[model samples]
Target: MIWQLDLILCLFIIICAIAAINVKDLLGAVIILGAYSFFMCLLWTEMGAVDVAFTEASVGAGVGTVLFIAAVSKTKRRSKD
Candidate 1:
């Protein structure tokens, strides 16, 4: 049962990762990346790595996502293409 849950979380993480990479909009991609990081943090927590999970949540999902949004806000919303 635990292994199954782990597998499911892993699958979600992979899906989020692919979505983040394939997304064309910078803001959307960054948000997807943040979701991916959040999933990773959940997986780490489930695996008993609370410290690592906390760091991933705080640094990867939290601060990193905010930074990306700030950077995106300063640029044009849509690309020239």
Candidate 2:
């Protein structure tokens, strides 16, 4: 049962990673990367690493995402294409 949950999380993480890389829009890719970080945090928590998970959640999904968004906003470049 726990393994099943882990498998599901891994699948979603993989999908998010692929989407983040494939996305042409910088903002969209950043958002997807945030989602990937969130899922990774979840996986870490599930694996009994609560401390690491919290760090990943706060830094990866929180401040990191905010910083990325701020940078993108300042640049105002929509997409490469």
Per TM-score, the best of the predicted structures is 2
The 0-to-1 C-alpha lDDT of every candidate, in the order given, reads 0.91, 0.93
Scored by Cα lDDT, where does model 1 land?
0.91
What are the runs in model 2 whose C-alpha is more than 4 Å off? none
Q: Give the Å shift of residue 8 in candidate 1.
A: 0.3
lDDT of 2 by residue, 1-81 (tens): 289989999999999999998888999999999999999999998999999999999988999999999999899746764
Q: Top lDDT: which candidate number? A: 2
In angstroms, how far off is 62's CA in candidate 2?
0.2
Q: After superposition, how far is residue 22 of candidate 1 from its true place, in Å?
A: 0.7
The residue pairs found clashing in candidate 1 are: none
